[model samples]
Target chain A: MAKKTPLDPAAAFRVPSGLAELSAIDPAGTPIGPQDKESGAAALADLGPDLAALQEKLYAGATGGSEHRSVLLVLQGMDTSGKDGVVDKVLGLVNPAGLRLASFKKPTPEELAHDFLWRIEKQVPAAGLIGVFNRSQYEDVLVVRVHDLVPPAVWEPRYAAINDFEQRLTDSGVTVVKCFLHISKEVQKERLLARLDDPTKFWKYNPGDVDERGYWDDYQAAYLDALNRCSTDAAPWHVIPSDRKWYRNWAIGALLHQKLTELDPQYPPAEFDVEVEKGRVAAS
Target chain B: MAKKTPLDPAAAFRVPSGLAELSAIDPAGTPIGPQDKESGAAALADLGPDLAALQEKLYAGATGGSEHRSVLLVLQGMDTSGKDGVVDKVLGLVNPAGLRLASFKKPTPEELAHDFLWRIEKQVPAAGLIGVFNRSQYEDVLVVRVHDLVPPAVWEPRYAAINDFEQRLTDSGVTVVKCFLHISKEVQKERLLARLDDPTKFWKYNPGDVDERGYWDDYQAAYLDALNRCSTDAAPWHVIPSDRKWYRNWAIGALLHQKLTELDPQYPPAEFDVEVEKGRVAAS
Candidate 1:
């Protein structure tokens, strides 16, 4: 008999609906993974082949001109929440040809001129691709809210706007997996200090990261609103406990693997007469 | 003391100057790796960490706004010559975020309206990114020559134009690594048959591939001319013997690793005052 899989990652990591605040889930907890660090990384390694195979089927179909489905993983976290690490270890398992990655930093003058969703729309995964957005539409809600960059009237409606955008994506065969990498304030201090401690890591340090720490509570409030309002049947928010780097990597890898498995893309059947093709090749 | 290293991959794989015939090198030869299959795969695994580390430095330097250097890997070959396989196995060794891959198929009507290099130029690797062009500007010369799609006056002069284009890429802090995945005519027949026998791989089989097979000598002549003419100091062509899939993967992996190592990207120094930021982070 097959061993029972652990809890559905969908249910295990799904942010609860009607959530009141951000303090509910333990940032250090491993809700659906091995209880230790080494096993977490090992588990991620175990997922590589299956992930790659599934991705290839999808890639084959797309490149073969027969498929039009895609997946988009949206990553959101406060500064130093390990979004980049998750991408390297987790999403990195699949072929890059089938993957599209976009990182949204502060808006440039051109980006600022457009509607928030304008640039986001352009980067949505093409058919058969799996796209990742390092920081995404949620930024308009979180950062914009925390800094009062826009009045509540403007920021308040974006949750609905985001949900509608995600709904449209799903309607067009896109599966959206939005993850909020949850890290504690103490962890942020440690990560920043560690970056400062290593000369090789100094480039990762931004003084603004420390300045943003002062807005930790504000970001959490904004994130709570995002999770509660936008989490829907079409695309739900998954709060990946990111305090442990190993656990964070494992969880995101597991979630993405689970999503791709659910899609179960298949190679398109032979378009030509197989016997005729074989005869032609044999002769040539 | 360190162990003796193998012949410089740079020299071992580079196509000879003034090559007038495609038959000069055996397409099935493994000139630069372990003669056995298992060791070839094992060797690629050994290069993974160094490849990943070097990629991180380039990614960091670019993302951190301190580096302008990038590498472009242009892959050109006949159908089923293992270009896609090399990308999956060799280029796949690096971080996906730092890697940019562009697969150029036949040009669209809009693309045809512009100079051949227009589309190729737009996709050149940005600063701090390693880009792979699955099929590139060389197609203009190779296929255009074989099909007589353009007159001698037009296609013949493309060699000089390509040289000028690549030279410009080098002058702008780009290192171009051009590889021609050389597979024999017999191997293509075998590979096409293999795809026919395997149902799952049928998506990869194209009817036109057989049509192209009929033009083998014409294509080979075209290739030799393009290889000899376009092979330049700015970006020489590396003729990878690709009959053994394992060796092809290893050779390309080794060549790319060697190229990245040669670029020697550095992690940028601290852009902010470290002690001051440390104090701010600690206090917060």
Candidate 2:
């Protein structure tokens, strides 16, 4: 008999040993099914409506007062690894009315004044919405570690703090899906060159992106440390191969689709007599 | 000779006397140009690309370190009066990358621990982004006053506090555009009934919305008081008649388009020699 495939997509790319080297994973690898770009695209297209329907159920359940569950998709990626593209393609599959997107840029003075998680806690999706953090609390460790923004003693403890924080969120009905969009350095260079070649893309081509490219090895090491330290049972980190945008989008979408399906959010039973309300409305 | 039309949309519906009663403005009034729905839609369509272009300039200028301007569109409206619809239609005209949306729901326990504006302050758009607040700080006065969530002594001082807060935002690079979506009780009733009749929209129809309908008079009074007290030179409030969704959407689009045109954010010159960079990129 064929070996049973893991039902949980999280099983495939999860940093299981908590010490998986980032360099071991191929940025162009397609770890899950569909084998090729066309099939992967087809699978994603098939899952779109299912995802939308599940979102509606989650929304209905929240409003109907039967369920208070929500999901937070935390995306951490290098420049040109298709974070925004994933947002536009995958999360964009659902009703945007129920989706909240928070992109964490550099910390403002006020944000810097508080603990790193203060701003993040405030932006966590309220009970029924799917919250997408384009870049999130992980930056506290990732960027801060790379740039020496804070001393090692300050940034080091945050891994445990983040685990505790995410655990609390899970306890309070939030399922955290953290994804690291892993891209090869060569692919990033090509993407950057493409941005330079195209004028329309120039708006997105920041000189800082090129500067950050120089720190690629440092960022990868920082990311590996973060993944190992913080990937808990409650919020496991998934390192997705992102050199192929199609596979990356599909993988994330498929993972979200599986998670929502597992959640099985139901449309709540009517609190009032639906038939009576229908009758009243018809009479009115 | 024909009287010169007011080029600024703010001139028409800006709470002029501050005592201009909510009851005095017709919820169905078409105060701006187009007399019909098609014309209003056409106007909105015409303004879309202009708005997009202005947003691009604002973003480009911010990145290029030449401009630091941003706009905050604060939308306050009754339930079923179309705040989200306006967000979808009007504010959706710009690039999502440049737009940040913060929807202030019922305060979380942590949010309650701080001053009301604490969470709000964290969500304000940074330089070069348009921040849209759906049901913003005004709620401290509006819902808190109507629902008796806090003592009058607690909520009353908030009007002045809000004016001060907005003044500070304006003193910085942020331009505050506060809009009150004004719709009649009759229109609200029709909207509520429509939601009841359509199963597809049931997710949006909270039973509490019907209960809130009973508080119509109190809400209007709360809105009027808030509008009168908070409209200021830096952050004037525009009461948009929202009985017609199309007109509301168009009026807001036109207003934003006009405001952005007035700001006329310019693209900053390249920080490095463009020709040299292009040569370097080509050589690489």
Estimate the Cα RMSD of every predicted model relative to the unseen true structure.
Answer: 1.9, 6.2
Q: For model 1, how does the per-residue alpha-carbon lDDT over A72-107 read when each residue is reduced to its tens digit? A: 999999888988887888877877888899999899
lDDT of the structure predicted as candidate 2: 0.83
In order, the TM-score of chain B in each prediction is 0.97, 0.96
Question: Please, what is the TM-score per model?
Answer: 0.97, 0.74
Docking class of 2: incorrect
* Local accuracy of candidate 2 as per-residue lDDT tens digits, B78-101: 998899888767765665667788
Largest lDDT belongs to which candidate? Answer: 1
The TM-score measured for candidate 2 stands at 0.74
The numbered model that scores best in TM-score is: 1
Q: Clash number for every model?
A: 0, 0
Each candidate's fnat, listed in order, reads 0.73, 0.08
- What DockQ does each listed candidate score? 0.74, 0.15
All candidates' lDDT scores?
Answer: 0.88, 0.83
- The 10 consecutive residues of candidate 1 chain B with the worst lDDT sum are B1-10
DockQ, candidate 2, vs. native dimer: 0.15
